[model samples]
Target chain A: MEKVDCIIVGGGLAGLSAAYGLASEGLEVMVVERGDYSGAKNVTGGRLYLSPIRDIYPELWESAPFERPVTRELVTLMGDGASTTIELASDRFATAPHQSYTVLRARLDQWLADQVMEKGGMVITKNRVDEILMEGDKVIGIRAGGDDIGADVTIIAEGVLGLLSSKVGLREQPTARDHALGYKEILELPSSVIQDRWHLNEGEGAAHLFMGEVTKGMMGGGFLYTNKDSISLGIVVGMEAMRERTEKVESHTLLDAFKELPHIRPLVEGGTLVEYSAHAIPEGGIAKVPKLFGDGYLMVGDAAGLALNALLTVRGMDFAIASGFYAARAVADAKNRGDCSAAGLAQYEQSLRSSFVLKDLETAKEIPHIMENPRLFTHYPQAVSGLLEKLYTIGPHPSQKLSSTVIGGVRKDFMNARTLKELLAMRKI
Target chain B: MDIVVSVKTNLDLQMIRIKNREPVLEAIPYKTGDLDKNAVEAALQLRDAVGESKVIVLTVAESNRKVRETIKEVLAMGADEAVLIVDPALESTDQAGVARTLAAALQKIGSYDLVLFGEGSSDDYSGQVGPRVAELLGVPQIGYARQITAGGAGVLVERSMDEYIETLEAPLPAVLTVVSEINEPRIPSLMNIMKAGKKPTEEWSLADLGLDPAAVASSCETLSNLAEEQDRKHIMLEGGAAEQAAGLVNALLKEGIVGR
Candidate 1:
């Protein structure tokens, strides 16, 4: 039996980040990835918030492969035939030490894996870990491709699916009820064109989100992020919403439809499609977050249900990188104490709870449930766009007074108790 | 018998993106030439067959951290050791320059009963390095080897040619380039990969081989390299299926493509 000080499964941001920290501590670490390389199998939708993770492994982020620092934020409320867009171009967001930067997982993960290698970490790719080697309810190691290897601690960062972890009873099997399906197309556009379309300076990025009619009143929306020379345009739809629809809709059709919308068409016109990817995202929030650590094992990244969708911004990568950082520190601490039992490794959960990873998740805990109501995706966008369209339009007849129109529109849409109650209910979150 | 397998690592061609008809080569991961992996497998099998044998992997590429990282793929695949001949000068070196460098590295590595190479690198496919190295080393070279076996005082090799397969026996200390049909390369196990870092590796430069850099520089300059642009003649035939079928047949007959 071969053994290492640590075996990190799945060479993703989580696993690679852990390996980077552990190797810096002179610990023997190995990362087993199923893809040809670390980022080959990863999908992000698709920006990383740097502020949350700037302090942890700050040196690595300095030279990280960031596409562009997002400066402009746009959210469109799509109605039947009219859509209203709110654009926020803040000076602070565009300044030095930006908050978030768009990232391509394939480039980002591979670069992080390279850094891990530089730190004397072994990242093994193109091999799937078939089983988590267990001994009497304790995960001791992993068996991958007929290679049985042991380790003092096994960090299961196997990502969103977590098939092996679930098969071993470490986590619950993912259901359509607790997940979302994201489909993205990387459309190549010249840097000048991206800047012109999104109205940006050189190397500045924009994040455009569309709600309401985009997801067909479903509990999901459309997102577009500008990259260095490409724009990642994608749509996310709740899996349960998709499965429960009376009309069968192929996921790709939704993307094609989105590209054809009058507002979206010109934005993507003449753009060549480079890569199309679809992935399942964990949408369970903190409630579904599994036990972080237990005898000889710890689960980080999506495997532990650590993703959050705050409507304004979708976050998972930062939580993943941060969780991996904490996992490494906990494992190193446990190894130094010469005890890897559940009790010894319990610091992982406590540290994450204190870190921004869990705190942010806890702050947004009710978002997943609140977003489950389809009216937020449907009624709100329609009401807002409809009211604004009426206020701006001049019909064939005489128009009403601005004050009367405002009151009428408000009384029509905002007077209902259900709507008010919904609004007040959201204040807690 | 000590065996040496020479490999060339190229940017993963599949991941290369074409921009403005030119390849976007930045950030592409480097990979061993597909057929060169077959050569490594052949050497490994031969080493195991002949007791008290060892296999040493060799390459001549850019002397960078990425190249060193790329070489680990072969090292993890059961190779006993590796000798990397890398220098900044080899970046633009041509096939002939590569042959000169590998021949010199082979000489520096001393005794070997067999040396192996792929018929051509996966990237260039110039099919010149193996024969050139064999000529420079003054060893009998047999290429396109599909089967090789150690027998008596020599080895028997079955070579696939344009017309037929030829079987011949070559004495000890020969160079053979195996075709991809030789054997399947084994995926390195997790344990082997973990231990690959400990395997003794030697790095050298043209300076170490006592060769001048400019003497082996590329002789020819490439004027341009662009992806072939293909235009589709998207002709649409309007009508019912039967009419459209007839129109399609007529178009093909007019173009002499089919329906003659």
Candidate 2:
């Protein structure tokens, strides 16, 4: 049997971050990944908010492979044939330690795994960890390929599926309501074209999110993040709603409709589809988070359901990094005390409760429920677009007061007191 | 019996990106050649059958980060040890140069009873390395072996030659190239992967093997490498299902791709 100070069961951001932290402190750690490499199996909407992870690896962006610093943010509400957009751009976003950057997980995760190895950690790829070895209810190691390897501590950082965590009873199997299916395509274009289309300067990028009919009234949205020489565009739809969708409304059909939208087509015109991928996202928020730590074991990243979908910004990678960092700290503390028990490992949850990871999720816990309302996906965006159109159209004989036009549009949608209250609640997030 | 398997780290063709009709090869990720892994599996199988043998993996490539990762993968696949010849001068080495460098490393080790090579590399299908190495080492060589069995102090191999299969025997101390159908490679377990890091991997250069770089210079030179731009006529056949079917059949028949 082989022994290590720590065994990490996935090489995603969370696992690699924990491995990096443990290895940097002179702990022997091994990260076993089932993919050909760390990021080989990961997919994301392509923008990573780096503020939360700046402290994890202070110099991360200095050496990491980032597509571009995002200087522009655009959010659009799409109606049947029209849309309303809010665009924000700032020069401050282009500086070092910038707000966020666009990245392809395949390159970023591999770079992080390399960093872990360079920090004296070991990473083994193309190997699946079949099961966690236990000693009287304590996770002692992992069994992979019919071989038993022992470790002082084990961390499961598997992504949204959380297969290992569920198998080990850390959490129940996620249902359709708790997960979302995201399909993304990487479109190849010239760097100059991306800059021109997104109104970005050299080395600057944009993140654009689309709500409303882009999802074909499904409870989901479309996203586009600018890479250096390509565009990452995709749609994310809730599985609960997707399951109830008629067979004629397939997920790819939704993506195809989104691509043909008047506001989205010109941006991706003449681009080659280089790659397409689909992945599951854990959208269950803090309410669905499982028990984070146990005897000789810890769960981080999506395995712990540590993702937040705040409508304007959907984030997981940052949360994964933060959780990984906190989990490693707790594990290191436990090791220093020579206690690898459930009581000792409980500090991880404590750290998370006090940290931004859980706090942010707690604050946005209601966003998922609010987003689940079908009218929010179908009625609200169209009403808003109708109100804007009434305000903008300059017909010769119909010059009504702006307030009356707005009131008329709202009344047209049958926005009564209850609907107004619901809209207010939805806006609170 | 001791066996040495020669593997090559080639660019993952699937991951290759074509830009402006040119392949962006510099930063593309590389993996151990797919069929070369079969050769490694064959060598490991021979060792398993012989009961007391070692599988030494050998590769000649530039000493870079990508090559190091590739070498680790080969080691994890059950190679007892590895000999890596990573030198800047060999970055563009041709088949002949690679064969010479490998032959020199084998000669330096000096005790291998058999050597294994893939019939051809995935990136460059020049199936000359094994035979050229044998010629340089002055050893008998067998090419395109689909199945191999160990006999007394020797091995017998089954090979396909054009339209016929032939069985041949080679005494100890010979070279053999294997086809992809030889055997399925095994994925290393987590424990074995951990142990692979501790396995002895010795790095050598051309000078370390007491060979002059000038004598092993590449003979073949690549003039131009470009992605083949395929001009596809994406003509959409329209109308009802039966009409479209008849139109497709008519098109194929016009192109002589279907029955008359």
Best by lDDT: 1
Q: What TM-score quantifies how close candidate 2 is to the native fold? A: 0.90
RMSD for each model, in Å, please?
1.8, 3.4
Alpha-carbon shift of residue B65 in model 2 (angstroms): 2.3
Clashes of each: 0, 0
lDDT of 2 by residue, B87-162 (tens): 8788767888889899999999989999999999998898999999999999999999999899955999999677
Give one digit per residue, the lDDT tens place, for model 1 in A99-131: 999999999999999899899999988889999
The whole-model lDDT of each prediction reads: 0.91, 0.88
- Report the C-alpha lDDT of model 2 over A334-400, residue by residue, as the tens digit: 9999998999999999999999898899888888889888888788788888789879999889699
Q: After superposition, how far is residue B79 of candidate 1 from its true place, in Å?
A: 1.1
Candidate 1 segments whose C-alpha is farther than 4 A from its true place: B151-153, B233-247
Could you tell me how far off, in angstroms, the CA of residue B43 lies in candidate 2 after the best superposition? 3.3
